[model samples]
Target chain A: MAEGLVIVGGSYAALHMAQGARENGYGEAIRLISDEPWLPYQRPPLSKGFLAGKIERDALALKGEAFYRDNGIEVLLETRVSAIDRQARTVTTAAGANLRYDGLGLALGARPRLLKIAGADLDGVFYLRSLADTLALRERLARPLSIVVIGGGFIGLEVAASLATLGHRVSVVEALERLMARVLPPVLSDFMAQMHRGRGVEVRLSAGVQEIKGDGAGRVASVLCSDGSELAADIVVAGIGVVPETGLAAAAGLACRDGILVDDAARTADPAIVAAGDCVRYPSAFTPDPCRLESVQNASDQGRAAGAALAGKPQAYRAVPWFWSDQYECKLQMAGLSPGHDRLALRGAMAGGRFSLFYFRAGRLVAVDTVNRPGEHLLGRKLLAAGASLTPEQAADESFDLKALLAA
Target chain B: MVIYQLKDGSERRVDVPAGHSVMLGAVQNDLPGIDAECGGCCACGTCHVYVDPAHYGRLPAVEAMEDDLLSGVAAGRQATSRLSCQITMTPALDGLVVRMPERQG
Candidate 1:
């Protein structure tokens, strides 16, 4: 009931908004409301380290309990805000409690896009998103079983890699012709497919899930593909994609298009309202089009921007976007967005499993994808942030001193 | 507990559990200096800190990822400079002191 800043959701963006606001000298009661039972935690490791049991649950927490208490951040975990009244400047919780806020931040995040095929609702079919979902999936994976992972995006591939590493019979069914076709270039997609195949995972490209056949006891037994092929599967995990949680924002009459529209400062059309994280589509310095990014970098930076705006010192959120994925022995690190890059220049050998792909659009460095090349990836981020240009020839030459350009 | 020596010569002592990293100690306690932007993934070198020379030798060797990342840190690297996330606290190093860098990227 504190009449100050009220942030909705429990994730990176929400936590950062609270922290950023407090750090920016927002001396008021800040309340973070979330439907999740646990405090905000990192989602990146859920499919990799957490599923592989390399990372403990405690380590997944974004910040410790003492953080919220000491920072005067009132956390309302397991509480969902059902409605937002912009007129009254109050949020109505699912429990019928209305909390007033001088400013509101919507970090609604996103939800898994469930399969709409036949028998999709059967047991033994899961989606990985929250801690509860991961725990349930992990529990079901106690024994070795045939797992059919639908989709080949980051989540699906990470899950596929984890399950395959765990010695399970795994198959990746992708509707597209290549793995991670949307985000990765054709070459990297081929590399990913080859990598998965090398790790004993059956990579099924251009195979769409037609139906998930269920056992007589209501558990999934097999997955029927669009090619009329059937894969014997004891478990089905679909990571098709996610739909932004923009219903509340839209209902409250906020501008929304696939995601809630926000400015570079993470502020919505309404000056008193702000949005960040996966649920927001905002302007970016890297791209001409306003985009919505799902990486920890985007979430944290946008969250910080939202907090700064909430604290009355609004600055543009233009941090270079970067993402990382650890699969088996390969660490794929990508910096910048390469949506419309016309050319890709490779630096290093793919055979050696260490390389960097520089994506250029209209003769300008657009993005960089580096595999097992942490140094290149970090340099790419800096290069993009500085708006430094690199020629394809220079990028291809291994001996070219990339660090010298930072000084330029 | 872990002591974070701020760039301003101030010190922040926080009670971070043994299993957590030194970066977690500063972040969880709301210490201002360390950004830890990548959230301990060692992908971003923002959590760069200078370990006290006295306790620097006691810590484990820096891994390749951390080493590679340290090269890109904003404050520049030093012999005693280490990524706080790479340094997990232990009972043997209860009095470990890590000095925050001038800034993080």
Candidate 2:
């Protein structure tokens, strides 16, 4: 009997799993099923280069089509998996094709949370998530027009920055008092607010969108605020956040919370099935509680772990998590989670726009956020992965060679 | 076209349109060695590459961010080290040669 491997979703995790499985000597037939028609492409550029018209659609592809064919990896594009028969170890496709597999990997990513407000379905209202959304947004950005970006997260801010760079009048309305409140400290948030404002972006914080009002022509005309204010907008982009795609997994009787529940090995409740990427909530040393990460680093690392396990390697997932966001001239790099950090030490002049914030919890270095400081970001990931100990004073001292701490 | 010399001694010459970064060129071609985990934002040092010394001086001066990132290259930094993502391809850089570092941090 010939055993086979079936992978769901077409994203970074799925590609990494296939690569990892091959590297681990999994010579069996590997089939990847994706609902999207295109090959697995990188998503980070969609918010930056793709939106800016600097990168073509073909440039976003992670691997050339020939690579998959040469590797003997079968990719069933535009095909959706309808059901998983755990008892029969088979998966039914949307076209009613039953595919048998010895192991299943779920890289089901996430979808952007849509604005459920009135006039959200208006013609000019948009959400940035898929290639289709980006292509649509790019076309809309062709002519100069007033743009209102809802939400202050990375996607919203990046879109605002790109639009402003392209000479469009941009305004950002954030519901929270500070921008990026969920991930960044108040200080960084304030700095970002100032930066955005300096770039000719009208930033309105602590303001919620009451509703997106449309003109009689079914086009977005203005955004009404909770504070009884309205801002005229030709285009309205909503980027509140994303929710993991877990409906399919839950239907198959897999353990799921906000995301599909998985162990460190990327294995779900059923050993025959494993999951990775944005859709899985897995245990991590970086966080006190199990959490779901929506970053390229998380997807690739977790997928590698799942693939290795599926190949019988069975190693635990322990890769240090890292993330980056580019807005205008600033490049912010973050390493590890800093949820419970009680103290923060600044390593450089914040006014200079080149500094690293060392986050410490109980006098131990836990995480770092670097603004245009890549050396510190890299060393920070290394130190956190190595579990190195450094006091706030040592971190604050510019004379100290942070790289030396990696050896300790 | 920009030429990239891999650590394994293989060379790849990719057609990179102007305004696109050298990292994007390698990435679009699916060339090995450049991880570019941060997607050419100059945040991740995964796209570290050594410019062929002959063409190093002809390239634009290294920016502060690229210099900072080069310091973190896992393969060890050299005077020619540059984050390929930061170097935009131009007509003058027609024969530009970049060598991939042994490893990218």
Candidate 3:
């Protein structure tokens, strides 16, 4: 194993690689180069509790300095890796310092995609992807007024829910045919849309924002949709989604597609480098489809896996993916990938947001989305890992404890 | 009261009580930007901010989770890149300029 590991892009992947490199018995210098200039933090709450004001800022530290010092990891925050010299096995920073690395792991996570509307650049039309965005939104939230959020993805819906709880009039404009169309079932999305609307969020389906009009002062005030309707707002939140941050990788001549292309081993075109997090497209475990995910689980797992591999204990990244989001009082948890599913099996109380839906593909449980049911979600993760096939009867019966099925 | 410079070059004057993390202190006063998601347990790694290297020693010793989280954050974390939640305003960080990370995860 090399005596040093340098990981790039300080999000979940950067943190995991630093820790995993030490744990994997690589008695070497571990360094992380991050562009954000902050500690490795989790993003799940950016759209949930933190946005809702339930969680405070200091509570978000992933770890303190002791972990790095104890583990022999060097972290360079706020340093942007401007260029990766593939031939030299070195990275030059934005500040004009070049560092050599034996192995490199890129956790350069995805970024929120720019909103497709006029006046998106105007003040008050913000995206809910970063701490800064949430903090800025909170400034607008202080007055307890109306908020117009574009997109019905997880972030948008959660932001809508949080603003509604704060007594802000909320409206969500989703260009999608339905909410969470990529991850959720139609029925569940419908249920979720109802819940938000019930809380006074006017969710407009199939409504794409054609143009956003800021006030005379250059602050967002309303959105004009393709449907030729005007939606008023005190502020606009665009959770449209994200694109992988792979400019450095692509510039360095790495294979890039929807994400950096990697095998199960999380390796890029360069054997000396690897990629993880929402920025890489890798083989999926539950099915044949290659997937690129924006979930925290993927970022952490891929970072850890790539870190270990970079340490020469090369193993394919095949961990079951899981993620959780807090919307209002509802804790939505997902286990496995829900792609290519033929039907969804329901358990628990869906109406109250206390149930779960197990997605089955070819009679096998491929993925499960649970709301406020952690126990079932845990088992569902195991089920996905084990490729556990389940009968519909077993799924429909709430009396059928999922853990027991795991044992069987 | 302590004055801290945010990432955006704006100065935030936070009236922190005695013995509160600069991160939490800013948050308590309704500072618009710090989001500490783990309740300051040092887990979840969301409350990351870089302290001015010039004034790092004024802060408290970094704990285990704080270190762990920093390691994972984008490494520009300098001698000053601290989980702001881990920093207590000890009058030493009086004029500290803290910068926020672009994304928590």
Candidate 4:
């Protein structure tokens, strides 16, 4: 019997692992098991283009059916992996099928954190994570309706911008004083708040959601804030954050922290089984601490690394992490991690609506956040990947040629 | 139809509707080379391509944002380099040729 490679989840990481396995010359059966009914698709557009009705469902697919068939990859859709038997090298599915594998790849992605307040289970309450969620939300957005978004994270802000673009009255409530407080600097956070407010989005800062009240019809009607104010809402969305899915890895006796613990090669303690994407925590030069990333760049890079390792051509995963978010007219591009940064250098004037935030720690360039400035984001990725060093003053100089630094 | 001459010298001709971008044309055809990771948002530079110099000036003028992004391509960028996603397909520009770079960053 020819041994097969079994991969779990239907997100970017799982798809990339399959591609990597093929590219690395793993010729045996390649099986991808996904809980979603559809094939792997891009998720970034779920909040922007899909929500705004600019792209259709077919455009979201990462690979067509012909690609899978031509590549000799079998896809098991709407199937869930119940357990992994490490000793036997087999995985049991929810459909009562036990499949044996020579190698196992776990790309179990994260799930959205739900709001724990009252009326959380109401009909009109939604959380955007999967295609189904986006479809339902898009249906609700067909007509102009008042929307109340809880949390000021990327997902919340993206949804707010999408709903507002659809001509809906949208309000964002952030428990923190500014938007994107955890990832972005104070100045950028303040700028984002002003940008949203300027676009007629009611950005309520330093406000906590007390409860989501439902009408007698059992649909969300209004949101009650901790400040003793009620804001009428036709729909409510909660985008607080996501919790990594690691139950299967832990149940199978794999090492796990907040996520499944993997090495630089994306391999677990059991060499036969490997994990990647948001579900796995690994150390990278980009951050001082071990971290789990939820971006597509991390997923694709780590998935390729895991696949390469499984094919006996292991390569250390050391790519600079990059992410982008589209809100209104601004395209915010970020590269590298900014943890423990001591100083920030602004490349351009913020009033000009195009600038890049260069972060440095101990006078060494660390990360960058660029708004409508793709050149800076790209250069920052290269600089961080090369582990280059530069002073804060040099980074702040407008006449400095960032591309020339890469040549040096 | 928009013609994409890949880095490996293979040719893929895709029928891109007027409103769609050349990146979407390449992506919808599953033509290898264009990643379009941001879904034609012009945020990620994965869809970098070198427009054939003959048809480069005929298309719309490169915006400041697109010019900045093209400057950041991981691979060495040429004077003909332009992000395929920012170039919209039009009937007047039929048979436009774009060559893929060695690799997109």
Candidate 5:
């Protein structure tokens, strides 16, 4: 009998890999190893619905328990893989158990980049990554408390908005000059800042955290900033960003950079090993260089590609990247990559907080950002995936039917 | 319980609790053919389904956002086309029938 396929890690990437493998007819025994105590669950809602108490814990499950059992996917929860012995084709678990595999998958997702300043580890300072982190933060949010969210990225702004809506005093601090500067242009970033401010969140930009000060009981009391300003806080949440977990791959003698190096088929340098999701930087049609995307779309599509490879049917993954962020009553949807965009066109009324921004690079449609406009956003995904183009004038005109472009 | 009509002339009966969306039923059951990539947030249009004509009207009216999203599904839109995520399961909707598209965009 074959040793079967062994998948390491949990979350969308790992879960989808198992599903994809089974769906593609890889019938050998499948074992999924994860360090998380809980079954693989959705992480996006942790900051929004779950934090707001609108979505229950049971609803977070990606798939029901019976699904895994019925599919013959054995899930080993709370088991950490200490080392990978590529020569033996087995993984050593922390408990001294070695699991053998004919093929291996590295779905090791990213981890939260921690704050390194003094008092960073003090109680009341939290990072949102795992369900455990969110649950702890949720428990802390049971009572109204002053919160200084230390980032203006999507995660930070989202947590701030969720807490503010729950009637908590919230303040957002971003080291950048504008919110989400790394992704969105200044125009959208300004709109985000205004939206947070209108909802009673103090949006502070261009300020870096110097240190976190602890109280007499060793709990976070306030955050000291680089400009000598201090914000009182009963708790602090850092959403700086994430670092791809490439340690396992690197230790196993695989090529690793910012992420584990992988090909279009999510294959590493080793023929028997494949990687996907946030941990692997792979070639994409949308980017001039290999990039690692940390979105649900990337994880699911790339995991599917990895599964196909494991099933001996490797195909180049070409799924278009798309993402969404829900803050307050507004929904921000984005499609495609737009960092090199030289022009932008707007459709719909921005004054009412509902509009779409089209990004163009040298007269070619590259990406789009739609706020409260799901129609354009959805059309944008289809258009981008098809490599279709639109003139700036056509994209700006509200009367222009985007569906016609898709049909064409 | 819900009946999912597949493109291959097959059907899957899944027991989805009331208040959960129709997409969640297929996803949680590990049923193939329905890809709720965005986790039923209506962000991705992958979970497209064609409701059985007789039971179509029994579901809630499509909102503006969902209506706009329906036009862009990978499978060509049908008069009965609806994003499964937009349709919530109700006791009255028990044994509801929804057909998955040949492929999700």
Candidate 6:
């Protein structure tokens, strides 16, 4: 049995691999390391239910104490793996703890990128990523505060929705022309913008943050934008984007592109070393060239794949990517990876709220954004798994049931 | 074979196979109301069913996570509320009538 070190920033990938290793009879030491003080919890709900007071801190826990103890895995919290010495198969944590392992997994994940400005270092400036970040932001929710989210991506809009629901004035500024621009098309983005604005959230697109101004007390007071706008704010949250955690991997002589380069098996330059979750830029099942995914499905699926391979069940990871986000009254579910597409097949009705837009590349269905359409999303998941492509005309027709389309 | 009455007054009969989880039986036959989000791993706590008071000892011991997820539900959980995923269907479960809770957190 090989001892494994799953260096992780969060819990999802770490927990899954730990359990996988245990189930596969790897009785050796299975240790999980993270910078956070708490055990792993589901992060998808952090921006919605968890922030809205619907979910408590205990409810956010990934697994209870017994789950870890029963499986014979040791969890080390608030420990950051600063350096990785691949030749020695050892890792040095931030606190100077050198731990050796027979096999290693880099589920290090990514962090929210913050805007560099004067107010960025000031008080009341935030980024909603970890449970701690949510708890800190939740404390400000009850203070009758005004918020300015620096980006209109999923993170920003979700924060705006949560704040507005808590009866706070929220403004979202995005450098893109519309909201969710990275994942959705212009029309769908506009629809989401309308949805957010209708809920009384101030949504400003094409408005990049030039400088964040602070008050005399070192608190965020206002935001100065490229569009000649200055909005007053008691708090500022930077949800601009995220960069993959690849520094330790790079230092350890692992092949680093934009992310840790790996094959479909999620094996890096050293086959004994593997990377999963948001850190590894492994090959996509549908598209060409390797890519790094920051989504939960990518993390869990890749972790399971890598775990199985490490346990002598060697197989290439070829799973379709899927993710969902809950904002206000809508549950947006997307199946298949939503990028590298050429044409669109708009299904159902977007403005009415229940609709789906299919993203196709060279007449092959690559992705589908299903808003309140769980059936379409499920069918899309199956099709993408089978590499089954549907035509734009077939998907656009409301009479053609998604189930029938799948059978075709 | 077991017959259970739904909250809406509809009746659904399912074959409670031996050694299979009751939630697995309901899901395989599309009896509805059992949404096992974590795939019967007791992680998501979606397959919550309130067992009849008379049928408590018929199931296995309750695990920690299965008990924790039940605390978050809306309904008044009695001695029952077994995570259907955790219950392995046995010959003892024949003619068992466990009510499905209307909501899952």
TM-scores of chain B, in order: 0.96, 0.96, 0.79, 0.95, 0.96, 0.84
State the lDDT of candidate 2 residue by residue for A85-175, as single tens digits. Answer: 9989999998999999998999999999989888899999989888888888888877899999999999999999989998999999999
User: What is the DockQ score of candidate 2, to 2 decimals?
Assistant: 0.69
DockQ for all models: 0.58, 0.69, 0.04, 0.59, 0.63, 0.06
TM-score of each prediction: 0.96, 0.96, 0.79, 0.97, 0.95, 0.81
In model 2 chain A, which range of ten residues has the least summed lDDT?
A: A58-67
Error of 2 at A226 (Å): 1.0
lDDT of 6 by residue, A71-109 (tens): 777888888888988788788888898888888878888
lDDT of 1 by residue, A258-282 (tens): 9999999999989999999999999
Give one digit per residue, the lDDT tens place, for model 5 in A1-408.
399999998888888788788878898999999999999999999899888997778778999898999989999999999899999999999999999998899999999999999989999999998889999998887788999999999899999989999999999999999998988999999899999999999999999999999998899999999999999999999999999999988999999989999999999988888899999999988889999998988998899899888878887999878889999988899999888899999888888888999999989889999998876787888788887879989999988887787667
- Tens-digit lDDT track of model 2 for B1-105: 899999899898888998878998887777889988877777888999999999999799998888888888889999898999889988999989999988885
Candidate 5: give the clashing pairs. Answer: none
Across residues A218-265, which tens digit of lDDT does each residue of candidate 4 receive? 999999999999999999989999999999999999988989999999
Off by over 4 Å in 1: B12-18, B90-94
Where in model 5 is the C-alpha error above 4 Å?
Answer: B53-58
Error of 1 at A143 (Å): 1.5
lDDT of each: 0.91, 0.90, 0.76, 0.89, 0.90, 0.76
Which should have the higher TM-score, number 4 or number 6? 4
Clashing pairs in 6: B20-B89
CAPRI-style grade of the A/B interface in model 5: medium
Give candidate 2 regions above 4 Å deviation.
A1-3, B10-20
Task: Report how far residue B8 has shifted in candidate 6, in Å.
Answer: 29
lDDT-best of 2 and 4: 2
Model 6 CA lDDT for position B103: 67
Any runs in candidate 6 off by more than 4 Å, and if so which?
A: A1-7, A405-408, B1-105
